[model samples]
Target chain A: MYSVEELVWNDSFINWVRYNKNSDFWESLRASDPAVEENIRKAALIVKAAAATPEIPVEESEAAEVWNRIRRDTAEPETGNRKWHWAVASVAAAFLVFLGIYNYGKTDTRVSYENLISEVASSDYKEIRNDGPDPVSVSLPDRSSVVLYQGSKIGYSLSGYNREKREVYFSGEGFFEVSKNPQKPFFVYSNELITKVLGTSFTIKAPENSEKIEVIVKSGKVEVITRKDPRKKKVLESKELEEGNYLVENQKIDLERATMKLSPIVKRELTELNHAVQQMKFDFDEEPVTRIIADLELAYNVRISYDKVKWQGTKLTAHLSDEPLYDKIEMICKAIEAEYEVRPDKIVIK
Target chain B: MTRLWRSFIAGDEDAFSEIYEAFFKILYRYGYHFAADHSLVKDAIQELFTDLWRLRSNLSDTTSVKFYLFRSLRRRLHTLAGGEDVYQALPLSENDLRGLQTDSREQYLIDKETEEIHLKQLGEGINKLTTRQREALRLKYYEGFTLSEAASIMNMNEQSVRNLIQRAIISLRSLLS
Candidate 1:
């Protein structure tokens, strides 16, 4: 049977659109056996149900720390990851000809980050190999679990997982579901990249003789860094693999071992634009115009300044769905017969 | 949410902040499932959104905000745990519940049996469940009373008894989630 993940992600399958060129492909296949449609429908519902799992409520206490972190991050825009990625990329691009040993260390933290990862990767660990046919599941001292694939080997602390750090040296493939301990950060050394996590689940596939290493996120965030640099003097220790990326669920990062380049594609990044809030139909039945505009501003995350007191009594019934923000504004303006001006950060209605 | 996300992607500072505010708790609920360590879950959640905001410009458009946050939080937690997805289901069956299923009591149904565990942890978890749910569960599951019997004993309606049982299930699931 076709895989569920692939089929759900396949828009053509979900939408059931068989165009002329590929028509013959599915046509001939289904022509031989017409009963295949049942499997397709069941797969669609299961995939849909996966997305429609009961809404889990996130507690207010749980959100407090995350709120602080995001605010602090976005608040300081200049020093963010994108800026670092760009600066390193541009430097790499500009001085590719002079790409020997250089001291581009002071300005960017990439240098220190690279060294930190290298230092972690080269640490001491006891090795366990899965030569047998069955997958070997290892329980760490701290209770984190590792399922080693056949022919793969992993190394961890020989003295049992030390309190300060939990490290794993892996080659081939493994699935990890690490127990949580905030003090000791978890590190997986796979190929040139080191996957670091505090407490989460993820998988790393580093097959022997393959040009690419794939790290797929099962859950939680992890920082991926390249152990890409060779030994240089104090001038520079190491360089980052194009700044780190945090891959979320249903996302995969493919790193070309040849170039030490990493690229991530998160499912959220490629969604079919499914917004639950936007799906709510808006039919203002003689409601205050301010209410309408307010809801719109809230939904669009835009600011709309208008004389609310004057328009408090104004009421109108209008239905709107799936229209562009500007178009929605235009319709509201036409109904209210109010003039509007588009400002840089907001809209002004008079 | 689409519009907010569009604005966030467009590098609107306010929209990004708003998104953070809107989805932080929801992400937390999804995250706690991976690890029982509350603080660790919180830190992972903080790091997830912080990274998301940092990579806001790079994020692709998404339709399902809940799934997006959920999936992101799961990935974040796993990365922190330094493992693959921890949300794997164990081969739990009614037999595995230590004969809780055959008791024909509603308490077994309420607890949604798992392997035997520590008493203190179970107490802490049971404490979080509501009194109504507990009463309903005990009367219906422990005492082997029918839904209506439990309701009449508790002086409540059958619908309320059903609702109580549902709330109990939800409460128990939240502990795991």
Candidate 2:
């Protein structure tokens, strides 16, 4: 006959009692001997009693607050090299002047494009100036691509790029095709406007001399928030061009530089804005369904959820272009004899 | 879990956050069981993570992330407590004993009243064990650590850990009978 301690210390017995694993083996052992069955029952009791420890609750905010402290403690110092320190100081001075012009509405100061370029000209920043007559294509550290129009410039911090966030300061017209990384959001700062995206293609026109800025959404979603003081890093007001809205695609948002007012202007005949859309290729030849869904997810900045194992080895062969995003999804689902549901935050395909 | 650790060592911030999220609560419970100090446990856990990130480059890959974290947290709490006597056995709190009686398997084995009486006796019996015995029982039964892993965590040999758990169960069984 087995003893209680022997049964309690057995790994397979503990697994059976605690996790219901390998019940058949334990059952056969129990039926073989009556004393062993009694020992098994007692051992199971001991395991369950010992495993029933009290739990301590942790708040969600507590985790976030601790992470914030860790992030702050581990952040690199802003001033390191002495030579670059002087350059950063000059850029800070010029930035202060630009902020002064913005806050005071000093048209007499007349901040020129040259002043804007100098303001962002820190040694830590990777500045791209398109001096050629044609638009120059530039690649970001995260593999996102930007088409900088002639006589315009864009700059981003070299240290924090693609690490903490993908941020860039722009004073130009540019078409952006941002790679999808939901963890590190992409932000574009032009004058008072801050455009945030996860992944999408769009166009922004914010010239240093113009009193108005325009943001056109060719694909995906974009959030535009105003910042009164860039030093404070506080958002004043926000607007989002969400997907599924009537004005989602080829929609234009005009921001008055003087008042910082945002108004949406719907114009269906903005045929020139369709260049990026036409450039996207949606032809698939026996591509895996997961890959197709992933591509669509990146292009639209939307989350698509489906049973990966259930759809494993499922392939599609279709040309899904020219139609809207929903229609394209419907066509694929119909071809596969599946159904889809659009949730507020994600799309579910079954 | 090993994949998460590899990515974390490779400086993936998302993977680091995932590791923290996965292990924070259990680590908190383990530390609190010994010290019973809320802020002290919190500080120990925070320091554990901070040190892990700073020393990640020196860390080798490990398949048992839980064992590594638990051992590190225990060592950290030991230093923070300033003495080894902080591990003295304390009686299970009233709520903890109540938790024992509510175990579904115990209910399946016996009636509610008998279960309560037996669990009370078991709780008292468990409290009577040495601190090392109690730690061994917890690591082996509750945390599901294997004998060698528990031995390493407690700085004991495997045979001694097994003997500790054996004596603990024998004493508790006598109390129940």
Q: Which candidate number would show the highest lDDT if scored against the true structure?
A: 2
- What's the C-alpha lDDT at position B9 in model 2? 94
- Least accurate 10 contiguous residues by lDDT in model 2 chain B: B101-110
Error of 2 at A156 (Å): 31
Model 1 stretches astray by more than 4 angstroms: A1-124, A229-244, A268-350, B1-177
Q: What is the C-alpha RMSD of each candidate to the true structure, in Å?
A: 27.2, 14.3
lDDT of 2 by residue, A1-350 (tens): 56887788788888887777898998788779877867776776677666656556676666655655565455445344322211211100000001111233545424444454454447777889876544555667776766666666888878867876688888767667676677777778777666777766565665566676666655456666555434224321222234443224555566666666666655323343422222445677999987777666544445576666678799999785434456567888998899999653346788
- Badly placed stretches (over 4 Å) of model 2 are A73-350, B88-90, B93-112
Please state the CAPRI-style docking class of candidate 1.
incorrect
Local accuracy of candidate 1 as per-residue lDDT tens digits, B1-177? 897788778876656666766766655544554575678877887777777777877787874555466556666776787865454221223232333221233233223333233222233444455556654654443334456665664556899988876665444434432
TM-score of each: 0.27, 0.52
lDDT per residue for candidate 2 within B108-127, as digits (tens), equals: 54568866777777777777
